[model samples]
Target chain A: MQAPVLGVKALFFDVFGTLVDWRTSVARESEKILGALGFDLDWLAFADAWRGEYQPGMEEVRSGRLPFSKLDVLHRANLVRMAPRFGLENLSDEVLDDLTLVWHRLDAWTEVPGALTRLKTQFRIAPVSNGNISLMVDLARRNGLPWDAILGAEIAGDYKPKRQVYLAACAAFDLEPRQCMMVAAHSSDLAAAAACGLRTGHIARPNENGPGKGEASPSVPVDVAGSDLADLAGKLGV
Target chain B: MQAPVLGVKALFFDVFGTLVDWRTSVARESEKILGALGFDLDWLAFADAWRGEYQPGMEEVRSGRLPFSKLDVLHRANLVRMAPRFGLENLSDEVLDDLTLVWHRLDAWTEVPGALTRLKTQFRIAPVSNGNISLMVDLARRNGLPWDAILGAEIAGDYKPKRQVYLAACAAFDLEPRQCMMVAAHSSDLAAAAACGLRTGHIARPNENGPGKGEASPSVPVDVAGSDLADLAGKLGV
Candidate 1:
């Protein structure tokens, strides 16, 4: 383990691909909700399509082309748009709603729960994801992720990579940017957080998008980098 | 125990004097911080003086005479205002700041942690407090309060008793007002929440102001009422 940074009083995490394996988890959950409906297709591909719409949806709000909406609201709209291609358009709103909520039920990567529990002992931990407050709450409740508060896009009334999300999160905890650390698997998230004057910790999620398709290390400079959240916790001497 | 309210998916609690004994706890913490500095006076009276300024401070924000400020900021202002009356106006800013933060170190009532823990198993739990997110986070950390998210005045951009505060809390969770319950020891808080269409649960803190002073029963009609948080949890079958 490398030396830990001092003055880091809070740790803000990127939820989707950093703490949880959204691809596999969403794929499994979508299948459960859709398989019984006799609409079977490439479940992994389905999950990818669902996530693939995330950026564009957030861009609509980030760019001010559309008013800000909760991540689930956008997900529902995107689901309705993409369902026809997979022969799922005929489904009722009830089933489609169930499918949209899969984001709330994403399973944490194997070490996430234990790692977060340990990390929390030394610092205030929260998700600074693009996910909305309710979405974040559901994920924490379902996965045993102990967050000191729910804060992110919804609280900031904007999407991530935007400066408000990171800054608002730090201010919400009554800490200066230097006292908060952004922990994520993606180089992009760390870079944005660093731009806002926050320290950054990178957690390797090599299989986040499937084998060899995710970040094994941060592409940008960070205060700390490690193999996983548990490794990050160990590196910080948690 | 009375029958539990059906469809109550979330519980929003009023903090200070409700979940925790703010008066006594703040008095003790204030003495610990101030006594060593050679300031000897009536600590309980000191606590009352500090609390006495709270509503007036919040009124400044509620009336739009001042922009919304976190409870801590207003507390600091109130602290500085009251310092002269206590013959301690010469205190340094650092000392005054510490004095203002005693609100964060308050102790929970004896049955709060256990009851809250049990209720959490059946419903989503959070503090819809006038205290800002950081203040609530500090209190939760110092005590054993398990909150799913910190919500309330800060999130709503206004003080409680405002319609927006109650409505915004429900909207944040993607829940209808009817599906959420406002639990507090004050009838005024409950009445306001009920006016916003939320169910109400009352927890009696008969000694909140002082023994035999606080209402052992609510003055306004409530969906449910009990002796304390634990009894409310039991009434709800938690």
Candidate 2:
């Protein structure tokens, strides 16, 4: 399918599953933490369950079913509820606090840093994810992800698929929507960005759900599509 | 006098006259533009005259003496009034628009990027300047300065030495005032940050005024003092 060629001055990325593999990384780190605590549990199951709390939590706030809250607060609330379900109990507040920070320890995809470096040479690159500023900043520092700035839902006062979130980024950079591009693995994200007049690029992360798992195919008319970041970088001539 | 050792988590910089030698840089850039247009005025004098407008312009906004304005707007206003002084009359709107972006092209101190790199490994480094977000972002990109984020007076709706501007940086990083350090060559800037409970580090840019010229030394009680960025880094053990 032919896609429109776009002229983009800046690129905003979706941080979690799109730029970094949060699932496996969080699971591995949780497993290590459990091991250190002399406990055994299904790490992958815990990771999926932890991530399962994210969407509904965001939806709750987005729909005004709950008051405006930061992602860290939401993550902490979900962690407290999920701890006992994982056959873990009697955790001190300090331990729970450290565990809640699992989201901060996400691992970047192998292709992420190099691709971002190449793109940074040609365009303004930043994170326009639903993640809060501190979480995103910590993630970038820990993973060596080079971001020009952190533009997130906190600045938008709303979650993804909302025009406000996308527009907030454009406003922050003082660019018209057409001058900015959104890069994501999720069709829903690109759809929202495209609807808001931002150019879109889709980098397929087939392994985002692990082997034999597939995310829904992106349905939006993105300006570019590639199997991975390197392909996207090549396509953009970065 | 022995200064108390400060434990600083992040180093927030003052951009315009602190990290960037704006006077010299702006003078040189404007000279080139004027030279191309066959103007033969004293470029240094013109640059100084142009910069002289910055403070009064900002003060007008700060004192509620004028309506709220972005630095870009203020800069443009100043540029329009100063243009004829440099013999650049009847300039086309497009050329004038380009000239107004002179603030976006300010050059960084020679030690800025290298010192920032070293500090970044240990602390979150950002610019808490009066420049707007877009201006700071573009400046960092243009000069290859590795800033973790750009926190500006525009975000706080007030310019520095204002308490809100210093406190806003602390709030953005989720850091307490004492945990953050304000590093600047200007005593007034550091004093304001100190009043907000942030530790202050003074890096003496004796040559900020360019060759054979010097920046005025103002008295302020900073936690540390160093001769240059390299010295600051050394003192901080970064």
Candidate 3:
């Protein structure tokens, strides 16, 4: 539990479900975009169904069954596959493309901006997410998320929970893994990053999926833990 | 004359000469650091000597004489090779490493900060330099460059003046080359980018190499040209 978080030079973030609340944002985006197209359906379930394809899609790349494809590409393919199940058949390519980009337009957790601004004062900050470069860019631009670099899956040419993704991000900053901290809401992500020798900080995004549906606390040990990014920032002495 | 500069979505900058005055900055840094240890030489010439190796070093990778190496690695090797001439032979690895990082400590031109801030309101801005990610991050943090992403040679796995570097940057943003403008002070850089279908904007760095030694104007045609970054920002209607 006593990892050296104080001397960390970089903060590598897990974007989805950590910095951003994808469930409500995606549900809202789906409702607005698809609701206008005369599609009356359970948008939250639609959001859940779309997100449900995330792991299996990544597992394909992670297992080496398929070559490394960006998260955006995987999101699109997953969207197309699950579209029929929601009775949303024969959606135009443009519409499908628009929906796929829902991931890019998600809103950040409320306290993330202030925490990140404070954290940037002391450390290099970047997204170490499975999201592609462009997706991260759109989200940052939209939400004023001040990232020092867009790195991770696209830069590593591999997905996260894979050692390369975490290591490549640290290497990109020319810092040792122990000199960097991986901050995420998910223990699995933190565990993977920890296994790669990175210090772990947890931000409890209890409502990441929906009210009371996300990780409210870390199940595993971490160097630091906080109820939100602002608390995490304070905990880190930033 | 018309390359659709108005519709450009992203601005990819050439950092060394275009955004930062590397020669003066490096010379000052070298004198301050190395002179303290009692080694003296014509530091301006020293800066030039270090930069002088840039093209040949990159050409090694470009010509496939060597595999792709980050600009920092090439710079360190070049520094080590040239050190003996300046009576800097047998320096410890730490000192050599510190000297090589001079590239990461360069200052932005006087008007660059304001111009980039103004331009950021309308476009996504990032360095498309051959400089590695950490170098870009360091330069940005030092000078408040405000880049949305640190991308270029390191992410592209190759050096600029290469078509892949420019194309890969565009691909990283999911943007077409035509939708992005390559902004640099060097005509060769602009021309190479133009060949890859990117529009070009030139900001004259009249003293980038030395007084009257840098590009006062684009040698080739460009979509836009200006006295400096502020002028370029104005010309681009930002």
DockQ of each: 0.91, 0.65, 0.88
The better candidate by DockQ, 1 or 2, is 1
| Residue B171 Cα positional deviation in candidate 1, in Å, after optimal superposition | 0.9
**Candidate 1 interface CA RMSD, Å:** 0.6
Against the true structure, candidate 3 reaches a TM-score of 0.98
Per-residue accuracy of model 2 over A1-238 as CA lDDT, tens digit each: 2235456789999988888998898898887777899988888888888887888889988998887677888888888877789777688888777887888899998888889989888888899998887788888888887888888687677888779999988987888999898999998899989999999989888777777454534676788987888888888876
Interface RMSD of 2: 1.2
Candidate 3, A40: how far from true, in Å? 1.4
Model 2 chain A lDDT-worst window of ten: A1-10
lDDT by residue for model 1 over B1-238, one digit each (tens)? 3444788999999999898899998889989988999999798888888888989999999999999999999999999888778888898888988988888888899999889889999999999999999899988888888899999999999999999999999999999999999999999999999999999999999998777878799999999998999989888888
- Among residues 3 or more apart in sequence or in different chains, the pairs in candidate 1 whose N, CA or C atoms overlap within 3 Å are none
For candidate 1 chain B, which ten residues in a row score worst on lDDT? Answer: B1-10
**Relative to the unseen true structure, what is the C-alpha lDDT of residue A146 in candidate 3, on a scale of 0 to 100?**
84
Off by over 4 Å in 3: A1-3, B1-3
Displacement of the residue B76 alpha carbon in candidate 3, Å = 0.9
Instruction: Grade the docking of candidate 3.
Output: high
